[model samples]
Target: MSENIIDTGKLVEEQSDYLLSFAMSKLQDLELAKDLVQDTFVSAITKLDSFENRSNIRTWLTSILNRKIIDHWRKAETRYTDPVSSFFDQEGKARHWLVEKKNSTSVETVVDQITREEATMELYNCIEKLPPKWRGVIASKYLEEKVSDDICKEMEITPSNLWVIIHRAKLLLRDCLGKAEFQ
Candidate 1:
Protein backbone atom coordinates (compact mmCIF):
# COMPACT_ATOMS: atom_id res chain seq x y z
CA MET A 1 0.00 0.00 0.00
CA SER A 2 2.78 2.38 0.89
CA GLU A 3 4.68 1.60 -2.31
CA ASN A 4 1.61 2.35 -4.39
CA ILE A 5 1.24 5.88 -3.02
CA ILE A 6 2.52 8.80 -5.10
CA ASP A 7 4.81 11.36 -3.57
CA THR A 8 3.06 14.67 -4.21
CA GLY A 9 6.16 16.87 -4.12
CA LYS A 10 8.16 14.60 -6.39
CA LEU A 11 5.29 14.23 -8.82
CA VAL A 12 4.89 17.96 -9.02
CA GLU A 13 8.58 18.43 -9.66
CA GLU A 14 8.60 15.82 -12.40
CA GLN A 15 5.37 16.77 -14.15
CA SER A 16 4.96 20.53 -13.71
CA ASP A 17 6.62 21.51 -16.99
CA TYR A 18 4.85 18.85 -19.02
CA LEU A 19 1.47 19.76 -17.55
CA LEU A 20 2.10 23.46 -18.08
CA SER A 21 3.07 22.94 -21.71
CA PHE A 22 0.04 20.76 -22.31
CA ALA A 23 -2.22 23.40 -20.77
CA MET A 24 -0.56 26.15 -22.79
CA SER A 25 -1.05 24.21 -26.01
CA LYS A 26 -4.76 23.80 -25.30
CA LEU A 27 -5.51 27.20 -23.73
CA GLN A 28 -3.00 29.57 -25.44
CA ASP A 29 -3.08 31.73 -22.33
CA LEU A 30 -0.10 31.71 -20.03
CA GLU A 31 -1.84 33.04 -16.93
CA LEU A 32 -4.87 30.82 -17.34
CA ALA A 33 -2.66 27.81 -18.03
CA LYS A 34 -0.76 28.42 -14.81
CA ASP A 35 -4.00 28.82 -12.88
CA LEU A 36 -5.39 25.59 -14.30
CA VAL A 37 -2.22 23.70 -13.39
CA GLN A 38 -2.48 24.97 -9.85
CA ASP A 39 -6.13 24.03 -9.69
CA THR A 40 -5.28 20.57 -11.04
CA PHE A 41 -2.76 20.05 -8.30
CA VAL A 42 -5.18 21.21 -5.62
CA SER A 43 -7.97 18.95 -6.84
CA ALA A 44 -5.67 15.99 -7.23
CA ILE A 45 -4.16 16.33 -3.77
CA THR A 46 -7.53 16.83 -2.14
CA LYS A 47 -8.83 13.65 -3.70
CA LEU A 48 -5.60 11.70 -3.52
CA ASP A 49 -7.25 8.96 -1.51
CA SER A 50 -9.68 8.23 -4.33
CA PHE A 51 -6.85 7.59 -6.78
CA GLU A 52 -6.80 3.89 -7.63
CA ASN A 53 -3.14 3.84 -8.71
CA ARG A 54 -4.27 2.03 -11.88
CA SER A 55 -2.59 4.61 -14.04
CA ASN A 56 0.55 6.63 -13.49
CA ILE A 57 0.28 9.90 -11.55
CA ARG A 58 1.04 12.05 -14.61
CA THR A 59 -1.84 10.60 -16.60
CA TRP A 60 -4.15 11.10 -13.62
CA LEU A 61 -3.03 14.69 -13.22
CA THR A 62 -3.53 15.33 -16.95
CA SER A 63 -7.10 14.04 -16.81
CA ILE A 64 -7.87 16.41 -13.95
CA LEU A 65 -6.29 19.33 -15.81
CA ASN A 66 -8.30 18.56 -18.93
CA ARG A 67 -11.53 18.65 -16.92
CA LYS A 68 -10.58 21.99 -15.45
CA ILE A 69 -9.95 23.33 -18.95
CA ILE A 70 -13.33 22.13 -20.22
CA ASP A 71 -15.08 23.72 -17.26
CA HIS A 72 -13.26 27.01 -17.85
CA TRP A 73 -14.28 27.07 -21.51
CA ARG A 74 -17.89 26.25 -20.64
CA LYS A 75 -18.02 29.09 -18.12
CA ALA A 76 -16.38 31.51 -20.56
CA GLU A 77 -18.91 30.68 -23.29
CA THR A 78 -21.74 32.01 -21.05
CA ARG A 79 -19.79 34.85 -19.50
CA TYR A 80 -20.09 38.45 -20.74
CA THR A 81 -23.38 37.81 -22.52
CA ASP A 82 -24.64 40.90 -24.32
CA PRO A 83 -28.18 42.06 -23.54
CA VAL A 84 -30.52 41.99 -26.54
CA SER A 85 -32.08 45.24 -25.36
CA SER A 86 -28.78 47.02 -25.81
CA PHE A 87 -28.94 46.50 -29.58
CA PHE A 88 -32.52 47.60 -30.14
CA ASP A 89 -34.51 50.78 -29.53
CA GLN A 90 -38.02 50.89 -28.02
CA GLU A 91 -39.39 51.33 -31.59
CA GLY A 92 -37.45 48.14 -32.61
CA LYS A 93 -34.83 49.84 -34.81
CA ALA A 94 -31.32 48.46 -34.41
CA ARG A 95 -28.88 50.67 -32.53
CA HIS A 96 -26.32 52.45 -34.70
CA TRP A 97 -23.52 52.86 -32.22
CA LEU A 98 -21.11 50.75 -34.25
CA VAL A 99 -21.52 52.73 -37.48
CA GLU A 100 -20.31 56.19 -38.33
CA LYS A 101 -22.82 58.98 -38.94
CA LYS A 102 -22.16 58.73 -42.69
CA ASN A 103 -25.12 57.27 -44.60
CA SER A 104 -22.92 55.31 -47.03
CA THR A 105 -22.76 52.28 -44.71
CA SER A 106 -25.28 49.67 -45.89
CA VAL A 107 -27.86 47.68 -43.93
CA GLU A 108 -25.61 44.62 -44.21
CA THR A 109 -22.91 46.55 -42.37
CA VAL A 110 -25.21 47.29 -39.47
CA VAL A 111 -26.45 43.72 -39.33
CA ASP A 112 -22.89 42.49 -39.34
CA GLN A 113 -22.06 44.76 -36.44
CA ILE A 114 -25.04 43.47 -34.48
CA THR A 115 -24.05 39.82 -34.93
CA ARG A 116 -20.25 40.33 -34.92
CA GLU A 117 -19.61 39.73 -31.25
CA GLU A 118 -21.58 36.52 -31.07
CA ALA A 119 -20.05 35.24 -34.28
CA THR A 120 -16.57 36.11 -33.13
CA MET A 121 -17.11 34.21 -29.89
CA GLU A 122 -18.46 31.24 -31.74
CA LEU A 123 -15.56 31.28 -34.19
CA TYR A 124 -13.08 31.34 -31.34
CA ASN A 125 -14.81 28.41 -29.66
CA CYS A 126 -14.61 26.50 -32.91
CA ILE A 127 -10.96 27.36 -33.30
CA GLU A 128 -10.35 25.83 -29.89
CA LYS A 129 -11.64 22.51 -31.16
CA LEU A 130 -8.95 22.38 -33.82
CA PRO A 131 -5.76 20.39 -33.35
CA PRO A 132 -2.89 22.37 -31.81
CA LYS A 133 -0.97 22.77 -35.06
CA TRP A 134 -4.08 23.79 -36.94
CA ARG A 135 -4.98 26.25 -34.20
CA GLY A 136 -1.61 27.95 -34.55
CA VAL A 137 -1.94 27.97 -38.31
CA ILE A 138 -5.41 29.51 -38.20
CA ALA A 139 -4.31 32.15 -35.72
CA SER A 140 -1.36 33.14 -37.86
CA LYS A 141 -3.29 33.26 -41.11
CA TYR A 142 -6.45 35.00 -39.91
CA LEU A 143 -5.95 36.52 -36.50
CA GLU A 144 -2.39 37.75 -37.05
CA GLU A 145 -2.99 38.39 -40.76
CA LYS A 146 0.31 36.89 -41.76
CA VAL A 147 1.07 36.66 -45.46
CA SER A 148 1.05 33.20 -47.07
CA ASP A 149 4.77 33.20 -47.81
CA ASP A 150 5.65 34.28 -44.31
CA ILE A 151 3.35 31.72 -42.72
CA CYS A 152 4.81 28.97 -44.85
CA LYS A 153 8.29 29.96 -43.76
CA GLU A 154 7.35 30.31 -40.13
CA MET A 155 5.41 27.07 -39.90
CA GLU A 156 7.82 25.17 -42.16
CA ILE A 157 5.00 24.08 -44.45
CA THR A 158 4.73 24.53 -48.21
CA PRO A 159 2.31 27.01 -49.79
CA SER A 160 0.01 24.21 -50.97
CA ASN A 161 0.04 22.70 -47.51
CA LEU A 162 -0.86 26.06 -45.97
CA TRP A 163 -3.94 26.37 -48.14
CA VAL A 164 -4.93 22.81 -47.34
CA ILE A 165 -4.61 23.47 -43.62
CA ILE A 166 -6.69 26.64 -43.95
CA HIS A 167 -9.37 24.80 -45.91
CA ARG A 168 -9.62 22.08 -43.28
CA ALA A 169 -9.73 24.56 -40.41
CA LYS A 170 -12.45 26.60 -42.08
CA LEU A 171 -14.53 23.49 -42.70
CA LEU A 172 -14.21 22.52 -39.04
CA LEU A 173 -15.18 26.04 -37.96
CA ARG A 174 -18.22 26.04 -40.21
CA ASP A 175 -19.39 22.72 -38.82
CA CYS A 176 -18.84 23.84 -35.24
CA LEU A 177 -20.65 27.15 -35.79
CA GLY A 178 -23.59 25.36 -37.42
CA LYS A 179 -23.94 23.02 -34.46
CA ALA A 180 -23.56 25.90 -32.00
CA GLU A 181 -26.45 27.74 -33.68
CA PHE A 182 -28.83 24.87 -32.90
CA GLN A 183 -27.72 24.72 -29.28
Candidate 2:
Protein backbone atom coordinates (compact mmCIF):
# COMPACT_ATOMS: atom_id res chain seq x y z
CA MET A 1 0.00 0.00 0.00
CA SER A 2 2.82 2.40 0.77
CA GLU A 3 4.50 1.43 -2.50
CA ASN A 4 1.28 2.15 -4.37
CA ILE A 5 1.08 5.51 -2.67
CA ILE A 6 4.63 6.31 -3.77
CA ASP A 7 3.80 5.35 -7.35
CA THR A 8 0.68 7.50 -7.30
CA GLY A 9 2.63 10.49 -6.12
CA LYS A 10 5.23 9.99 -8.84
CA LEU A 11 2.57 9.62 -11.52
CA VAL A 12 0.66 12.69 -10.38
CA GLU A 13 3.84 14.71 -10.21
CA GLU A 14 4.70 13.71 -13.77
CA GLN A 15 1.32 14.90 -14.99
CA SER A 16 1.27 18.16 -13.04
CA ASP A 17 2.75 20.38 -15.78
CA TYR A 18 0.26 19.14 -18.34
CA LEU A 19 -2.60 19.60 -15.89
CA LEU A 20 -1.45 23.14 -15.14
CA SER A 21 -1.42 24.02 -18.85
CA PHE A 22 -4.82 22.42 -19.30
CA ALA A 23 -6.25 24.44 -16.42
CA MET A 24 -4.60 27.65 -17.55
CA SER A 25 -6.04 27.25 -21.03
CA LYS A 26 -9.46 26.66 -19.57
CA LEU A 27 -9.41 29.40 -16.91
CA GLN A 28 -7.07 32.02 -18.46
CA ASP A 29 -6.09 32.85 -14.89
CA LEU A 30 -2.67 31.58 -13.85
CA GLU A 31 -3.31 31.72 -10.13
CA LEU A 32 -6.71 30.11 -10.45
CA ALA A 33 -5.31 27.35 -12.64
CA LYS A 34 -2.56 26.66 -10.13
CA ASP A 35 -5.11 26.46 -7.36
CA LEU A 36 -7.31 24.11 -9.38
CA VAL A 37 -4.40 21.77 -10.15
CA GLN A 38 -3.45 21.73 -6.50
CA ASP A 39 -7.03 20.95 -5.59
CA THR A 40 -7.11 18.18 -8.20
CA PHE A 41 -4.07 16.45 -6.70
CA VAL A 42 -5.51 16.75 -3.24
CA SER A 43 -8.77 15.20 -4.40
CA ALA A 44 -6.86 12.40 -6.12
CA ILE A 45 -4.85 11.64 -3.02
CA THR A 46 -7.96 11.57 -0.86
CA LYS A 47 -9.82 9.31 -3.28
CA LEU A 48 -6.89 7.06 -3.98
CA ASP A 49 -8.62 3.98 -2.68
CA SER A 50 -11.50 4.33 -5.12
CA PHE A 51 -9.38 4.91 -8.25
CA GLU A 52 -10.09 1.36 -9.60
CA ASN A 53 -7.34 1.75 -12.24
CA ARG A 54 -9.80 1.74 -15.13
CA SER A 55 -8.38 4.93 -16.64
CA ASN A 56 -4.98 6.55 -16.58
CA ILE A 57 -4.36 8.81 -13.62
CA ARG A 58 -4.20 11.89 -15.83
CA THR A 59 -7.63 11.25 -17.35
CA TRP A 60 -9.11 10.75 -13.90
CA LEU A 61 -7.58 13.97 -12.63
CA THR A 62 -8.69 15.89 -15.74
CA SER A 63 -12.28 14.86 -15.14
CA ILE A 64 -12.09 16.24 -11.63
CA LEU A 65 -10.50 19.46 -12.89
CA ASN A 66 -13.19 19.88 -15.53
CA ARG A 67 -15.92 19.52 -12.94
CA LYS A 68 -14.27 22.20 -10.87
CA ILE A 69 -14.06 24.49 -13.89
CA ILE A 70 -17.74 24.00 -14.63
CA ASP A 71 -18.62 24.75 -11.03
CA HIS A 72 -16.54 27.92 -11.06
CA TRP A 73 -18.20 29.12 -14.26
CA ARG A 74 -21.64 28.48 -12.83
CA LYS A 75 -20.85 30.44 -9.66
CA ALA A 76 -19.33 33.30 -11.63
CA GLU A 77 -22.31 33.52 -13.97
CA THR A 78 -24.73 33.79 -11.08
CA ARG A 79 -22.62 36.21 -9.08
CA TYR A 80 -22.37 39.03 -11.62
CA THR A 81 -25.69 38.68 -13.40
CA ASP A 82 -28.06 41.62 -13.71
CA PRO A 83 -31.43 41.91 -15.44
CA VAL A 84 -31.04 42.19 -19.22
CA SER A 85 -32.95 45.41 -19.20
CA SER A 86 -30.92 46.89 -16.39
CA PHE A 87 -28.48 48.62 -18.75
CA PHE A 88 -31.05 49.45 -21.44
CA ASP A 89 -34.21 51.47 -21.28
CA GLN A 90 -37.61 50.48 -22.76
CA GLU A 91 -36.49 51.66 -26.19
CA GLY A 92 -33.44 49.39 -25.89
CA LYS A 93 -31.19 52.44 -26.03
CA ALA A 94 -28.22 52.39 -23.71
CA ARG A 95 -28.93 54.19 -20.43
CA HIS A 96 -26.17 52.84 -18.29
CA TRP A 97 -24.39 55.28 -16.00
CA LEU A 98 -20.93 54.40 -17.24
CA VAL A 99 -21.88 54.89 -20.87
CA GLU A 100 -23.37 58.27 -20.09
CA LYS A 101 -20.15 59.34 -18.38
CA LYS A 102 -18.01 58.72 -21.45
CA ASN A 103 -17.34 61.67 -23.87
CA SER A 104 -17.23 61.23 -27.65
CA THR A 105 -17.28 57.46 -27.32
CA SER A 106 -19.43 55.20 -29.44
CA VAL A 107 -21.66 52.71 -27.68
CA GLU A 108 -21.72 49.18 -29.02
CA THR A 109 -25.06 47.60 -29.88
CA VAL A 110 -26.05 45.03 -27.29
CA VAL A 111 -26.63 42.32 -29.88
CA ASP A 112 -23.14 42.75 -31.26
CA GLN A 113 -21.75 42.79 -27.74
CA ILE A 114 -23.43 39.50 -26.86
CA THR A 115 -22.44 37.82 -30.10
CA ARG A 116 -18.82 38.88 -29.69
CA GLU A 117 -18.82 37.60 -26.14
CA GLU A 118 -20.21 34.22 -27.19
CA ALA A 119 -17.65 33.90 -29.96
CA THR A 120 -14.85 34.77 -27.57
CA MET A 121 -16.04 32.15 -25.12
CA GLU A 122 -16.24 29.52 -27.84
CA LEU A 123 -12.75 30.47 -29.03
CA TYR A 124 -11.37 29.96 -25.56
CA ASN A 125 -13.03 26.56 -25.35
CA CYS A 126 -11.53 25.54 -28.68
CA ILE A 127 -8.13 26.77 -27.55
CA GLU A 128 -8.36 24.70 -24.41
CA LYS A 129 -8.94 21.60 -26.48
CA LEU A 130 -5.70 22.05 -28.40
CA PRO A 131 -2.54 20.10 -27.57
CA PRO A 132 -0.41 21.80 -24.96
CA LYS A 133 2.51 22.76 -27.21
CA TRP A 134 0.23 23.87 -30.04
CA ARG A 135 -1.93 25.83 -27.61
CA GLY A 136 1.16 27.52 -26.17
CA VAL A 137 2.28 28.55 -29.64
CA ILE A 138 -1.17 29.90 -30.51
CA ALA A 139 -1.48 31.83 -27.25
CA SER A 140 1.99 33.30 -27.60
CA LYS A 141 1.46 34.36 -31.19
CA TYR A 142 -2.07 35.68 -30.97
CA LEU A 143 -3.03 36.36 -27.37
CA GLU A 144 0.36 37.70 -26.38
CA GLU A 145 0.86 39.37 -29.80
CA LYS A 146 4.39 38.08 -30.04
CA VAL A 147 6.41 38.20 -33.22
CA SER A 148 7.49 35.01 -34.97
CA ASP A 149 11.08 35.49 -33.92
CA ASP A 150 10.07 36.07 -30.33
CA ILE A 151 7.76 33.08 -30.28
CA CYS A 152 10.45 30.92 -31.77
CA LYS A 153 12.88 32.07 -29.13
CA GLU A 154 10.49 31.73 -26.23
CA MET A 155 9.21 28.28 -27.28
CA GLU A 156 12.72 27.01 -28.14
CA ILE A 157 11.59 25.95 -31.56
CA THR A 158 13.17 26.68 -34.88
CA PRO A 159 11.45 29.17 -37.18
CA SER A 160 10.32 26.39 -39.49
CA ASN A 161 8.93 24.34 -36.61
CA LEU A 162 7.11 27.39 -35.30
CA TRP A 163 5.57 28.02 -38.70
CA VAL A 164 4.45 24.40 -38.98
CA ILE A 165 2.95 24.39 -35.50
CA ILE A 166 1.12 27.66 -36.14
CA HIS A 167 -0.27 26.42 -39.42
CA ARG A 168 -1.50 23.17 -37.90
CA ALA A 169 -2.93 24.91 -34.85
CA LYS A 170 -4.86 27.33 -37.07
CA LEU A 171 -6.32 24.46 -39.07
CA LEU A 172 -7.38 22.69 -35.86
CA LEU A 173 -8.93 25.87 -34.47
CA ARG A 174 -10.77 26.51 -37.71
CA ASP A 175 -12.23 23.02 -37.66
CA CYS A 176 -13.16 23.30 -33.98
CA LEU A 177 -14.78 26.74 -34.24
CA GLY A 178 -16.70 25.77 -37.35
CA LYS A 179 -18.35 23.02 -35.35
CA ALA A 180 -18.85 25.15 -32.21
CA GLU A 181 -21.88 27.03 -33.55
CA PHE A 182 -23.78 23.80 -34.10
CA GLN A 183 -23.30 22.82 -30.49
Q: Choose the strongest candidate by lDDT.
A: 1
lDDT digits (tens) for residues 1-183 of candidate 2: 563464755766677877786676567889999888889888888887777787766667878887888888988887897656678888988887686767644556655765665566567767878999999999998899999999988989999999899889889988988886411
The C-alpha RMSD of each candidate to the native structure, in angstroms, is 10.8, 8.2
lDDT of 2 at 79: 86
* Model 2 regions lying over 4 Å from their true place: 1-8, 83-183
In model 2, what are the clashing residue pairs, if there are any? none
**Tens digits of per-residue lDDT for model 1, 1-183:** 464466778988877876887676567899999999999998887788777786767668878998998999878867865567667888989979577455577899877764774566557656877998889899898889999898899999998999899899889899888876411
* Candidate 1 C-alpha error for residue 29, in Å: 1.5
**TM-score top scorer:** 2
Could you tell me the lDDT of residue 116 within candidate 2?
A: 69
Clash count, one per candidate: 0, 0
**Clashes (candidate 2):** 0
